[model samples]
Target: MSGPVDPARIRDAIAQFGRTLGPDVLASCRALFGAQQEALSCAVPAAARDLAYGPHERHRLDLYGAAGEAPKPVLLFVHGGAFVGGDKGDPSDPARWHNGAVGRMAARRGWIGAVMNYRLAPDHPWPAGAQDVGAAVDFLRAHAADHGGDPDRIVIMGTSAGAAHVGGFLRLRPDHADLVRGAILLSGLYGITPLEPKDEEYYGAADSACDKSPLEALASTPLPMMMACAQYDPARFQAEYLGLLQKRLTRHGALPCSMSLPGHNHYTIAMHLGTSDRRLEDSIAEFCDRLFA
Candidate 1:
């Protein structure tokens, strides 16, 4: 194994980009984190790639896990692209680094990591993302043992728009109560704030966004949750994080396991997962272990 990625440098680079989400910012983040992640050589050999979980062209997933005597717990990860785009692994890079590194991280921790891609927006609207999430879960549950995973010990995690989908899945698919053992949400919107134009593209009219929102359902869901947001997340995401915390506290009299990662922005919060910085990855592993235990 190599040394960890320098969190301070990643933090400094993101600080220079300012706290915003856009092409320029996202490109810079991809380049910076991509280089760091690639250098780590952390891509675990995947058991399967581009496996179809649903009929749609975008309904694909990759699985990563080492061979073991006992079936490993499952960790399913959903990537973010503002509801329009994002891939489980970089197609341009055949090595499966970048966002796919998180899957490798899970495999290293003795878990079966499944990274999936779902239908995008404009063509596929609200409930589609959530529906795809359910489909992916169904697929994983059915085929987990075949890929060295325990179907019953499953945790679902998502970042940004992907987090929104996971939240929606929990809300729209009440049956998730038995399928999903826990959830990890990083910087997801929960309708605490009005929808942006891009969000409207996926959620439909601004009027019905609330009805499609996952706030009320998430606050009452029985699934174990570990939530987090970057210190420099865009104001809306930060507010959503705080809003969920407050709602959970009010509704359940306690907050979920959560954190505000400092010296990092929204992108780095997920981007730095496979790097030397163990803050986020360690927390995720600990959370998954507790759920399976």
Candidate 2:
């Protein structure tokens, strides 16, 4: 087992960046977390890669510990790239020990862990990601037993743009409620506010974006959920997180499980999974256990 992550060390490494979200900060944190994941390279089970969930080239998913026992709860993860770009694995590294580390962590905890890629924006546009998510869910549900997963106990987790897609699925495909047991959203654009520029590339102009926003729908949905934002995330994501909390509270009279991850930022928040940092991972496992129970 890996040792616990040193929050102090992570804080010092990014102190100079100071809450900025950009290539420099993202690169720095990627390298740091990549190294942490690399150290556990020998521990994670090999993943079954590039399984097609749809006809599109990007409709692919990788599953870890998939050939194991029967009826394990499913944990599907969606990676974020602001809707313009992102992948389930680090493109440059074939070993893929970094970006998809969360899936490996889920496998370690005895769940069928999945990481997937979806169609990008400017070409696919609004609802495409959600459509891909729906396809993935369908594929997983159909083959869950073959892959040692429980089709009915699936939980989808997403970060940033990925979270938007999950929220979109919830809003647009509420009929799938019986298939998905819960959700975890990290720093996603929930449509509580206007779309950012990069997001507009996916959601389109103001009117279209508003029409496609999932905030109102997600607020009223009764799905079990857990949400959080990084302590050092930019203001927009912070606002989105707060917006969802307030909306859910006002609409449902209660808040979903949530947290402000300390000593981390947007990138490191997800990157640190499987790296001895049990804070977020532990919470996710607890949430899953509660739902799967």
Best by lDDT: 1
Q: Which digits, one per residue and each the tens of the lDDT, describe model 2 over residues 1-293?
A: 13566657777876667689887777778766765676555567546788999999999988877566468888999988889888888424733555578788888888988899999998999999988898899999998778788899899999999999999998888686787998899989998777667778899987667889888778988888999898888888999999999999998899999989987788877878887678989999999999989
- How large is the C-alpha RMSD of every model relative to the true structure? 2.3, 2.4
Give the TM-score comparing model 2 with the true structure, all chains together.
0.94
Q: After superposing candidate 1, which stretches have Cα over 4 Å from the reference?
A: 1-5, 39-43, 91-96
Q: What overall lDDT, based on C-alpha atoms, would model 1 receive against the true structure?
A: 0.85
User: lDDT (0-100) at residue 229 of candidate 1?
Assistant: 98
Give Cα distance to truth, residue 258, candidate 2, Å: 0.5
lDDT of each candidate versus the true structure:
0.85, 0.84
Q: Following a full C-alpha superposition, what root-mean-square deviation does model 2 have from the true structure?
A: 2.4
